[model samples]
Target: MIRLVAGYATAALTMLVLDGVWLTVATPRLYKPRIGELLADKPSLPPAVVFYFLYVAAIVVLAIQPALREGGWRRLLTHAVVFGLVAYATYDLTNQATLKTWSTTITLVDMAWGTLVTTAAASAGYAVMRWIGK
Candidate 1:
């Protein structure tokens, strides 16, 4: 139980940090609103940061063990990548359409970053699992 909570929390924080980096350096010019803004606006939600974090963790939880248990790095990585992209793309497309901020360029950029970040976050969590288990 503790491990489960930690997994989600760790993922959320990871996403938040990555998001900060992206906002500060990746895409700062076009007024691209970030996770911070989203979360701040709604106290109920665990911030958009948590959304991404939970996303990363969820993917790893569902896909990682099965992949690692059954195959090799290729399988694990592939599962992570597919799940990450789907989550990222879904979030971006839904928000873009609703907010009327649709843009192919942005969509691709977000998807790319989301994929990379989600993979990184999940991998990081996996790396620290031993410590977390205790």
Candidate 2:
């Protein structure tokens, strides 16, 4: 129970930090020129809220916890990278296929960002759980 809670907390927090940096710092630099027009002029509150809540939970439960049980950081990171790739790929590919205005550049960049965020979060979660257990 402790491990589970710790892992979840760490993963969620790490994800939040990574996302905050990406959205606030990186977005203007990396994304604005590429997809500025597609972005909402004002932030959309509901979907952002929903996505973070669900995404962190899913990463903690599905990737971080499993990796903690099965092995060490390598396993956790592998799981995170694969999970991130698959999850983000689904979204990006779907958007590319259906959304007439979606940019391939954005899809590629987002996929990379998703992978990075999950990898960092999962690693942090696994490390935190190990430390707490010790």
Q: Give the range where candidate 2 is weakest over 10 consecutive residues by summed lDDT.
A: 30-39
- Return the top candidate by lDDT: 2
Under the 3 Å rule for N, CA and C atoms, how many clashes does model 2 have?
Answer: 0
* Sequence-dependent TM-score of model 1: 0.65
lDDT of 1 by residue, 16-94 (tens): 7887788568544533444334333323445654666556667657655555457645666677678878987997888
Among the numbered candidates, top TM-score falls to 2
Q: Residue by residue across 14-41, what tens digits does model 2's lDDT show?
A: 8888888888986788668876777788
Off by over 4 Å in 2: none
Off by over 4 Å in 1: 1-13, 30-45, 49-53, 96-99, 130-134
Superpose all Cα atoms of candidate 1 onto the true structure and report the RMSD in Å to 1 decimal: 4.7
lDDT of 1 at 8: 53
